[model samples]
Target: MEHADEVYDVIVVGAGIEGSSTAYNLAKFGKRTLLLEQFPLPHSRGSSHGQSRITRKAYGSRDFYTQMMAEAFAMTDELQKECGEQLFINCGCLVIGPRTADFLSKTKSCLKRYGIPHDQFDIYEQRKRFPALSFRDDFEFVLDKSGGLLRSDKILQAFQRQFVRYGGVLCDGEPMIDLYPGTIVSVKTTKGLHRARSVVLTLGPWAAKFLPRLGLNVPLQPLKITVCYWKEKHGGNFNIENFPTFTMNGAAGKHHIYGLPACEYPGLVKICLHHGPNIDPDNRDGVENDWVLDAMKLIIATHFPSLEKEPSIVETCIYTNTPDEDFVLDVHPTWKNIVIGAGFSGHGFKLAPVVGKVLGELATGQKPSYDLSHFKINRFFKTKL
Candidate 1:
């Protein structure tokens, strides 16, 4: 069906956290913006539908992200004030690992370099502080005071609402099927064609499907990750009040194992392995994987004796990873007006606000507020396309 072509100053595809954040920024800047989503609002098919996500400043030596987090946190605070809703909870976070692990020492050094308040807890101190957590004798813990949990689902909703309130147009259930890039980009979606002066592609796992059409091929792997929630055998042991968000790095051969304090599910805490099997995003639900579940059970039985060895509930989420696990935010080499944001890996949610702002600035031909050279797509251009 051909509908009337309505031109917009900017059109953002993939209305997840990144897309919504971009649209919100564009609209707030007084641009005639349009936001499009492939699925219905509040759907569980994508990565942003989760109830909670850990937000922290410690990035295991990634100081660039630590610098960007300052702005991201401030932006989130502004959004909370504007929406008049509680969007974040500062519950602190602990990174646990063996004393010899470089990640632990590097993270502690990074925190110290940034002057972020943190505490180092040896096995004895750890036991005294967080009795619910159990670890090996040689394990060391670093507490990040700035870390906490973000209400991810609510943040999406708040961004969309504030975007519309700022006069941005939102078109749900309209997936961009084709793009004709030129002086003015023509976006063809499932419902209709829309013309825009500039376009921002925050297409998440779907980036690999569309970027080829633009004559750019970046290595992006979409993995289906299992999110597990375990039941606490003793009530109040791992609840939100006392327990802090936690991560165990260099576990099970350098794979990250992380968890959040009990909040979403009563008497249940969220925990999962960070790495998963690569799979097609369309067939994410049917992918077979049991090793992660088995690993989580073993981890819980070994460390979290208070929690059940078996997960009470298991859900799925997708992660689009780059080789370096850093974000890809840059302008299209051929089409300067087109901005691309991809390969956030699994840690991009905490940086979405700054990412969106940078993407919007790129689309509008403005100087970005922060240094984005690290995130440029050129880093991956040397790879065989």
Candidate 2:
């Protein structure tokens, strides 16, 4: 493909889930959008790789997320229809935590407020139903019917294809080296210089590197989290029928452990810490730390007794987390034409579809379909004082 010096209506940086979805939405509106990526297409170097991601409307505190999931599900459904492929598989999800914990209580509140069907079970009942699970008396589990697994890579490819079908241009293997934010945002890329009416930066972990230069000081901590898959002792015990995706909360001061049923790798269940060790994305390929690996092993022993002590497959993924763990979605204070989406905090994949539409609306100067107050960039300013 030849590089052309042309001005697009919108320039989207980063071809991850958020960027691809936003580009697709813009192209659907017949806008000349350019999707940019630093790495070549379909590379596992980014956070958006992997076979499946848990997609569930199991927000404990953010009822707004539940509201957004309504639109997200519809949008994903439309994508599946247009692509003639099944990207979201409905396998349900099991959210387990102490009833007294904020996670479980707030989730129940959100479920009731949104009328999302879920079954609340005590620990005894949960242990009986799913014999592979073991929990104490204080812990309660909710079976969320609206949750399922999302084929992330396939979804990205599907959206990219749909965006092109709608006449969108994608420049993969190109990095945005410089950006001139003005009425016409000029972007200098490896391929060539391209101008666009508006720019949306959804660069995931690399967002902070450019955001501060744009007069937006977002304190983002990029952490390298390990994606460990533990082999199940009895393969059928972790099957989709017997096992469901689980999010576990420990007693006070203990971190959370979440896992998905066996699917990606046969006999291996995907599990990872809700938090991670702070590290740079460039050096994320280093050898795994013994302390972290031991901690994960302990978690599996305490929670999932049916899984092996050691992880059969270990991979690395990065997360840009915010202090409050909510997302940062807003326009730059100086450049209204420039929109930013960052600090997904490890739970952004399930909300990418709705977030893309919202980010696209912000870039295009259209009224956002949902309230943007919760995810505004100005919130951090209030905390500084």
Candidate 3:
């Protein structure tokens, strides 16, 4: 009856937010879960290492996702209580773009559709309210008070801790080398070959490494994103009291740029483009391109005039983006017990808790809490062989 040496109810690969959440939920549901990580714990090699991530309910017209935020926020609350730590801060977020632009218009529409309380401020009002931001008259603002920053690393660690609290096994620093999918999955890692009843691949940038061998090809673009910290001209101009998380649209050289208050890196505030140069996650060597840094500095100088021209600190992270900028969540076509979650692009952090819940549901053959239509594995049908 043994398919391999030993059996587990579920095995999850990748210890990022998605993998940890899936393992946490599976263990909470009484499944013997094994969470695997290629890198050592607390490594900054992946996308989930940052201190702050913006969380909001604003979407263009996607009411379903707008509604999902309620549950996502609730889950964050549950995580905070379970971990006995504060993970979210309601610092408010400002969405600045043209009134006719997709980002701005959709945000207002979604806010109205859900009757979510938001403030509509004019150009003058925005400039008056937030002196740190100096926008042209053409730009408008949609302020959502409910949105704020999530202590991202804390959230991931909380999930990992919670998963362990629920009797889940965590195997870090062991990269998953191979997968033989069937009713039971045989995973080959640097440590050894392990077997489990079901396997969930949330490998992020490394997803294609194992998936293509199984005859499934997805159009996932791996890019290197720059995380930069700019020094304050007045030393505390970008402090939390003066600055909240701001999302700027229609910025030159990039569509969106987000910045957190100067709480993470001392006198430096985190700001960078939402996009980055295409990169291979395996060989993310050398420093970032000067153009990317220049673009961000230009925006900071033009908009956030109070920040020092030079970036105080800089780091890099990899994002495995899908073409449509949506997520891919489904069981492998050839192996039903093998679940996959990828194509998170740049915005996967906020939905990590809920995504983990859905991945757990998929692995257990239970219906997911949210709609799975927009996030199907077959979206890349033409690309898949």
Candidate 4:
């Protein structure tokens, strides 16, 4: 079933946050862009389906992200204005850990370095500030005032809507079975073969298998993270108005945990480990993740006395991680017109605006504003393109 091969200025495969954002930016730039997605719109098959994601200006390890978040925050506000809808909640982001945790110390440094508004609370002050949960041990808390939660579904929808309003074509439920890279790339999807002067790949977990077919391989491991929710037992300040989005770094070789206050489900708090077992995205359900649920239960019981120990609801999300946690945002080593955005490592939803902006610039032969040295393919440990 081949339709008319209307050659577009750019074709972006994958309607996830990154790809949708790339198409949105391209359309905003007045480029004739086409966005293709394998799954149906609003499907829970990828990372972007998770209802809420944290958006913050400070990074514990990467300074580049800290610097880029300045624009990401502004872009988010701009997107909200364009959509005429509230896409985020400014509840702030609280990072809780031991006093000596590098995440705490480095994140504090990043806040001061970036001049992001933040407040530090000692163990006693933290207990007074947040009385809903108790720590296993004395833990200091750092609250990034520039951080908050993004309404994931609404944000994705806004990108698609704005992209279409800007005259970009968005096609979903049509999987790209093959790609032919050249001066004018030909993307062979299930429905038709689309032609474009340039292409951007942001296919999430599917990229691992899809890229190998193009004679290029990189270190993209997909992990299935078990997202769990617990019922609120004690009537306390567990609502978003009261509780902020929070992350707890592992103290001593334990699982790093993060959660959102009562947003995804009613009377149930979202909490899970920041790690998961690697698996093929096509066959994610085959992996046994009961151990992850066990870990969450222990975490909840140890800290969150207001919530039930046993998870009332369990869900899943996929994270495509590189050996290094940094993202892969660069052009194909051989094909200059084909740009790649992959290996977000689970923390990229907040940074997609900058990533998409840079990817759009690369696809359109425009110079990227940010320093992409940290995200280049050559820096990859495997280094095979």
Q: What clash count goes with each model? A: 0, 0, 0, 0
- Residue 66's lDDT within candidate 3 is 74
lDDT per residue for candidate 2 within 2-47, as digits (tens), equals 3444778899999999999999999999889999999998887767
RMSD vs true structure, all candidates? 2.1, 2.5, 1.8, 2.1
Q: Local error of candidate 1 at 370, Å?
A: 1.6
Winning model by lDDT:
1
How would you encode candidate 1's per-residue C-alpha lDDT over 131-246 as one tens digit per residue? 88787789999989999999999999999999999999999988888999988898998898889999999999999778988987888999989999999898898888888898
**TM-score for model 4?**
0.96
Residue pairs in candidate 1 whose N, alpha carbon or C atoms collide under 3 angstroms = none
User: Can you rank all candidates by TM-score, best first?
Assistant: 1, 4, 3, 2
The local distance difference test score of each candidate is 0.90, 0.85, 0.85, 0.88
Screening candidate 3 with a backbone cut-off below 3 angstroms (N, C-alpha, C), the clashing residue pairs are none
The residue ranges of model 4 lying beyond 4 angstroms of the native Cα positions read: 1-5, 251-253, 381-385
Model 2 residue 143 CA deviation (Å) reads 0.8
Off by over 4 Å in 1: 1-5, 252-254, 383-385
Candidate 4 lDDT by residue in tens digits, 74-118: 999999999999988999999988887888899888888878889
Query: What's the TM-score of every candidate structure?
Result: 0.97, 0.95, 0.96, 0.96
Task: Report how far residue 43 has shifted in candidate 2, in Å.
Answer: 1.5
- Cα deviation of 241 in candidate 1 (Å)? 1.0
Instruction: For candidate 2, report its TM-score.
Output: 0.95
